[model samples]
Target: MAVSFHSRSNSYPSRQHPQAAHVDEQLTRLRSFEAASSSSICQRFSNLQDLHDSLEKMISLSVTNQVLSQDQIEKLLDGSIKILDLCNIAKDSLSQTKESLKEIQSIVRRKRGDLSAEVKKYLASRKFLKKSFQKVLKSLKTGQNKNNNALAVFGEAETVTIALFETIFSFISGSKACGKWSVVSKMISQSTVTCEAEANEFTIVDLEFQSDKSLKVENVQILEACIQDLEDGIESLSKSLIKYRVSILNI
Candidate 1:
């Protein structure tokens, strides 16, 4: 082989190879950094003023940042206080609403109790009236079965009629006082029976005594008839009251 001499400047090197181009760029960057460090001038004069100015700027920036941070913390605290105030107001409103509900509950219970008591009283009064009416009817029936005299029957019926009238008067008075006059009206319209009895007796000696006394037997009979009619009227009223017991008590 013939040896060839080539200049070093024209020689191909691995550093300049295509594959190592990226590595060469890195080495060039490193050399630049080194040159900048080596060739940098070292200032001889005092640069205290410039240093002071830079420090002042840094200090100002730090103080501004601290002020901004403090402002943010204050804003956060204010927001928390506002939220707490709102929560307290809501709690007070809820408490008032609960008290109102309790009051409403009490009113409803009291009204219910009052209505229940009235119904109980009405039922009791109705039962007593029914029992009394039945007893009177039974006594009348028994007397009729025994061939009782008309006078006795009339007297018994008259007594019962009087008792019934008194009872009706009391009921009406009580109902009116309670603002329940409808009860009295119902009793009058629904139930009653008229019972009348007539009897006659002739005495020969009684005629002589009546003439001496200037008394007319016909007048006596007329008066007796009138009294019987009055008793019958009372009986009719009693029967009417019994029939309307339910309606009257309802009022």
Candidate 2:
């Protein structure tokens, strides 16, 4: 007897399959995870960048002038410790974000083999977004590492500047040098104001991302926008740090 084979329908059944429902649920969770993690990662980066800017300003001020008051030295030490603590916090947050991404990736991979064509398209888009997000996260990690290295250099520079300042303040304290130092001090003070204003802007941007409702994985354009914003911010931050480093070296 000859056996007959029927063609399979591409359409979903009137009743959903258990596996398909599970895949849908996983995708929904993945969307939520991605949005939350992106917001958290961006906010942490913003805070880290703000701390870096503040520390750079303090380091610049410490070195720009040949002399420093006892009060100024104390402030620099306090600020240095604060920046280190903030860096640690940002690092922890980054680690958490990575874990969250990994979990989502695992969930998707587990169900990917059984996915239907329509569902596969959704998964493929998600994978692309995930890879894009991973790039952003890697950029953030690189930036954080750079910040760590900068912190070390800044700390050493600060130590040398403090020792020199103490020596000059104790021995020379020339009236003309003091006058020049006063002008530098005012410039540093203005830089602090600028740092605060920039930080406020970053906070507003962070909040906007945190509250964003369109970051769903199904909405590819919005997801891409979020990634693009992160890339832009990272580029801006890199340029600013380079400029600050050059200025510090000149001083």
Candidate 3:
């Protein structure tokens, strides 16, 4: 009896190979990592966008009033600098996120399973975030320009008002007419009160901006009212100065 020895088949078909199972496990872990990274990127973008909005509101508040106290002005400048720092951090994170996504996409493409849809979604979202950030940056630049203009205007107005006050004071001091001098003194006192009140109003506006809930419609209205009050006070002071000048010339 001739017995043929049985030979094992070249392929094992009863169970999955160890190498295939290991590859599948690795692929699963990579997919989970990809998903987690994508979520993180989305969250970071959202946080950055919120910060951008806050910065814009702060800028608006800073530029609304021209006559901020030195302390208040310093606070605003510090706040703006902080915002810029935060923006830079966000930008760096965004860049890192994009690089991570690119590396993941390349890995997914080489893997057995297709992840084109997920990768495409992340790429599109990144594009949208880039555009949004650009727009916010443009707005920030515009706000800075406005602040500079407001500062210039404030300086000019302050110089003129100070000079006018000095001229009126000197004229009143040199005058001999008691009645005219009395009227001028009263006008000067009223103008000083008006100017102080305007400054107080502006301070209140600044306090509102510094509050936790700074971006309210009510804050905007308050700022507008303060600006109006400031304008009226300046106008009244100018009128008082004009009256003092005319009185001095007549005397």
Q: Top TM-score: which candidate number?
A: 2
- Sorted by TM-score, highest first, which candidate order results? 2, 3, 1
Query: Residue by residue across 165-228, what tens digits does model 1's lDDT show?
Result: 2332232122222222222333221121110111111121112122223334353354334333
Off by over 4 Å in 3: 1-72, 75-82, 85-89, 92-96, 99-106, 145-251
* lDDT of candidate 1 at residue 167, scale 0 to 100: 33
Each prediction's TM-score against the native?
0.18, 0.29, 0.25
- The ten-residue window of minimal lDDT in model 2 covers 168-177
The lDDT-based order of candidates, best leading, equals 2, 3, 1
Q: Which one wins by lDDT: 2 or 3?
A: 2
> What shift in Å separates residue 241 of candidate 1 from its native position after superposition?
76
lDDT of 3 by residue, 1-251 (tens): 13232333333221143433443343333224311122332333333333333223322332232233343344444433434343343445334444534444465447654444544454455445445544544444333312343233222222222222222222212212221222114334454334334333223322222333223444335444433333343344334334422332221
Residue 246 of model 3 has an lDDT of 36
Q: Among all windows of ten consecutive residues in candidate 1, which has the lowest summed lDDT? A: 36-45
Q: Is candidate 1 or candidate 3 better by TM-score?
A: 3
The models' CA-based lDDT, in order, is 0.29, 0.36, 0.34
Candidate 1 local lDDT, residue 105 = 38
